[model samples]
Target: MKKLLAECLGTFTLVFAGTGAIVINAATHGSITHVGIALVFGLVVLAMIHTFGDVSGAHLNPAVTLAFAAARRLPWREAPGYVVAQVAGAFAASLLLHFLFPQDTTLGATLPLGSDAQSFVLELVLSAILMLTILSVSTGAKEKGITAAITIGGVIALEALFAGPISGASMNPARSLAPAFISGHLSHLWLYLTAPILGALLAVPLCLCVRDSTCCCASPTSGKS
Candidate 1:
């Protein structure tokens, strides 16, 4: 219960602050550029991780939660509830942002449908990288190095640089879904969900394939003496 609530609020913060920056930037002539938008998204994730990380692991994206499940870091039973909470919180934040900034049509939303396939493919690939990096940095094996925060933020900034102009670089399903509904634009919703989820799912196997078996706990063998 507390964990779910934390996940909800954390996700809401990510979309609200990050996309809200988009709305504000678009409304102003030169106040904030693409770089600024990317910064907002990255910084929001950084702050939120430090905020709700200890409680809920700050998984603001369904894709992320699913990835953790796939990696066996999170129990499968808890995923559905976490995803629901995250989506609800995101949509609520979107509604608030819409109410606050009615003049900004973009509202820091994801890219529209019919965008070039070249860009879409890039978004998908980069999104996968983002998920993979998140899993790697946040896992118990690596979190001990105090690199989780920095690594996740760095990956976000790097992916944003790659995908910001193309498909809005959204590796987060909840972040994309809320604004789409609030703005009444369902364009490319599939890409936003499919690409990120697929990317995140792919990370599970990819991480396992590269993980050092020696670092993991050894199993007891009955026949061994």
Candidate 2:
């Protein structure tokens, strides 16, 4: 129960702070700027990982949680609860944003600025890189400690800096889903739903290549997963 609550709270904070930057920026005519928004996302993730990481492994993103399970870091039985908590927290944040920004349509939802395929491919790569950094720096399923914080945050910042204009640099399903559902921008939702998970799963095999066999497999103390 504590783990579930940690996930929920971590996800809520992430969605709220990150997307809230977009909403405020749009409302204020980009005062936050693209760079500022990217930094907000990176910093928020860092803070959350440090805050709730030990409790829930800070799997605020469903793709991360699912990928951990796929890589055998997290148990399959617990994946559903993690995903549910993440989605629920996202919904809560989006609803609140909708209430606050009734005039805006996207509610900071991730929309493809280019063709669906283009955005789909971009999101896939972004998620892959992000998850790869995560798995490499993390211990087991836990994204605790300084190295995990800096690397994960740095990746998010870099991805958002380069890809936000083209693909929204989502790399996060729950983050993309809440605003889309709340704001009724579901036309390209399938890409977000599929790409991040696929990319994250793809990182599992890649991890095995760059890391020792023990690092990517399942074992309590063998650094597998």
Candidate 3:
């Protein structure tokens, strides 16, 4: 229960602060800028990992949770709960944003700025890189402590910086889902949902190849740190 609550709260904070930057930037005519928005997402992720990481492993992204389970670091049984908590929190944030910015069209939903194929490939590669970093830094399923927070946050920021223009850098299904659902921008939603999962799953085998067998195939650990 505590873990679920932590995931919910952590995900809520992430979506609220990150997407709020986009909404506010649009409302204010780009005061925040693309770089600023990317930084906001990175910084908020750093803060959340520090805040609730010990409680829920800060699996605020469903892709990360599923990847950990696939890597045998987290039990499969726990993945669904974490995903649900993340999605619920994301929806809560998007719903609030919708209410606050009633005239806003997308509410920070991720959309493909180019061809769907282009964004899809970018999202897949970006998610793979992000998951690789997480798998490298994490302990079992948990992404806690200073190292995990900084490295994971930095990777997210970097990816968003480069790929935000094309793919919106949505490496998380829950993060992409909420705003798309609320704002009714579902045309390219399938790419965002499927690519990240496939990418994260791809990282598992890559981790096994590069890392020691024990590192990627360790016995499942408790969800908490």
* Candidate 2, 92-176: lDDT as tens digits: 9989988888998898899999999999999999999999999988878986477888889889999999999999999999999
Clashes of 2: 0
Clashes of each: 0, 0, 0
Model 3 clash pairs are none
Tens-place lDDT digits, model 3, residues 1-225: 899999999999999999999999999999999999999999999999999888888979999999999999888898899899999999999999999999999999999988999999999999999999999988887864688998998999999999999899999999999999999999999999999999999999998899888887778977363
> Which residue runs of candidate 2 sit more than 4 Å off their true CA positions?
220-225
Model 1 vs. true fold: TM: 0.89
Highest TM-score model number: 3
Model 3: how large is the Cα RMSD against the reference?
1.0
Q: Cα lDDT of all candidates, in order? A: 0.76, 0.90, 0.92
Superposition error at 184 for model 1 (Å): 0.9
Q: How close to the true structure is residue 107 of candidate 1, measured as C-alpha lDDT?
A: 62
Candidate 1 local lDDT, 1-225, one digit each (tens): 877898899899989988888888877875988788788788888887877777777788899888776666676778898899999999989899989988777666688434657555766687778877876676531232346766787788778876677678888889988898778777667778788888888776776677765222233221210
Residue pairs in clash, model 2: none
> Over 4 Å off in model 1, which ranges?
112-116, 140-145, 213-225
Candidate 1 lDDT trough over 10 residues, lowest sum: 216-225
Positional deviation of 215 in candidate 1, in angstroms?
7.9
